[model samples]
Target: MAWKVLIVDDEPGIREVLKDYIEMNFEHTKIETAENADTALKKVTEDQYHIILLDIVMPGLDAFEFLRRVKDLNSLIQVIMITGNSTMERVLESIEAGADDYLLKPFSTKEIEEILKCSFARIERWRNAFRNSF
Candidate 1:
């Protein structure tokens, strides 16, 4: 299946690295980038994304807030929070705010691949369930 993914982060380098790695390793995946929460929100409304890689330190609207908004917009969309800080409180907060998963900053390509694999599996299951319901 072709997957649509959005990478939202304030740092251009993080966005580029993620985009590059995913593009290089994953086939038939469409990836987009947003530099801030506002732009990310606009894109989320405009497009259908199976997975979103969102940063927790965005400049405006806050990352947790953004995650909640994204969940409101599409409960089926899986959001994986990206953070430089790995505090337990923040991780718990993200999960409580409706994030599907999270990745620490400076993550390896292997980690990204693993998380994406899990997200894709869950997405597939959701799609199948929706189809069966119809």
Candidate 2:
């Protein structure tokens, strides 16, 4: 199945690495990117993304707030918070706030693929539940 994935980060390098790895590994998956939360939010509002890979520290909105807003907007949107600073507090906060998973930055390609597998599995479960609700 073709899925839509959004990568939201302030650093261009991080975004490029993620985009390249994802495109290389997943065929038929469409990847889009946003440099900051503002642009990401705009993209989220305009389009429906199956998965969102978000950065923690950003200019306009922090990952915590962004996750809250996006979850409220659509609970079906699966968000994975990625950051270099993986403090225990922030990890707990992201999970508590409804992030599907938290990934530490500088992740290996294998790690990225593993996270993608897990995220996609969760998304499938959520989608099944949503369909059952009807």
Candidate 3:
């Protein structure tokens, strides 16, 4: 099955750019974008995503708070925090809030591709183990 990925960013340019890159590079993935946290939450509630690429600073709800709220909503959903301002505090907060991974803004597409590859591999392993047990 194609992996479902949600890209949450307040900036339309960033969202579009990331969506295009993911779609072009990751053939086996479905990409969804949410401009704000509220819409992202609504999407999360309605569908199951394999991974979430969340912007740290947003208008309605910051990524940390959103991560806290959604962490328990879907146990299989892994989050990768994305931020332009990569502060030590923000990194620590994301880790403490249960972020599965993080990417600094202005990152290269190759970097993101690598991160997704690792994340998907881990997800596949978990799914395989679960299926085997059942």
Candidate 4:
């Protein structure tokens, strides 16, 4: 299956790392990057994305707010929040606010692969169910 992914982070390094890693590991994947929430939001509106890797802290708009807005645009888009500042409260809040998954910074590529596996499974399931429903 082909996947459309958006990587949203304020840092250039994080964006490049994720884009490169996903490109290297995942076949038939198209990835885009945005350095800030505003640009991310604009991109989201312009295209359909299957997955979003978002940073918690960004200038202009908060991550939670961006999540909310993105969810509003496409509830099916799987959003995974990535942050260096991990907290129980933030995790709970992110989940409650409709994040599909969470990951901490300094994470291994293996960890990202796991999350992507789960996300792909979930998306495939949803697609199947939708097809069956029709």
Off by over 4 Å in 3: none
lDDT of each: 0.94, 0.91, 0.90, 0.94
Q: What lDDT does candidate 2 reach at residue 120?
A: 85
Count clashes in each candidate, considering only residues at least 3 apart in sequence or on different chains.
0, 0, 0, 0
Candidate order by TM-score, decreasing, is 4, 1, 3, 2
Which of the two, 1 or 3, has more lDDT? 1
The segments of candidate 4 whose C-alpha lies over 4 angstroms from its true place after superposition are none
lDDT of 2 at 127: 77
Question: Which candidate's TM-score is highest?
Answer: 4
Q: How close is candidate 4 to the true structure, as a TM-score?
A: 0.98
What is candidate 2's lDDT per residue for 11-57, written digit by digit as tens? 99999999999999998789999999989998999999999999999
**lDDT per residue (tens digit) for residues 19-84 in model 4:** 999999999999999998999999999999999999998888889999999999989999999999
Candidate 1 least-lDDT 10 residues? 57-66
| TM-scores vs. true structure, each candidate | 0.97, 0.93, 0.95, 0.98
Off by over 4 Å in 1: none
Better of 1 and 2 by TM-score: 1
Error of 4 at 101 (Å): 0.4
Q: Compose the digit string of candidate 1's lDDT tens values, residues 15-118.
A: 99999999999899999999999999999989899999999987888988888989998998999999998999999999999999999988998899999999
Error of 4 at 111 (Å): 0.5
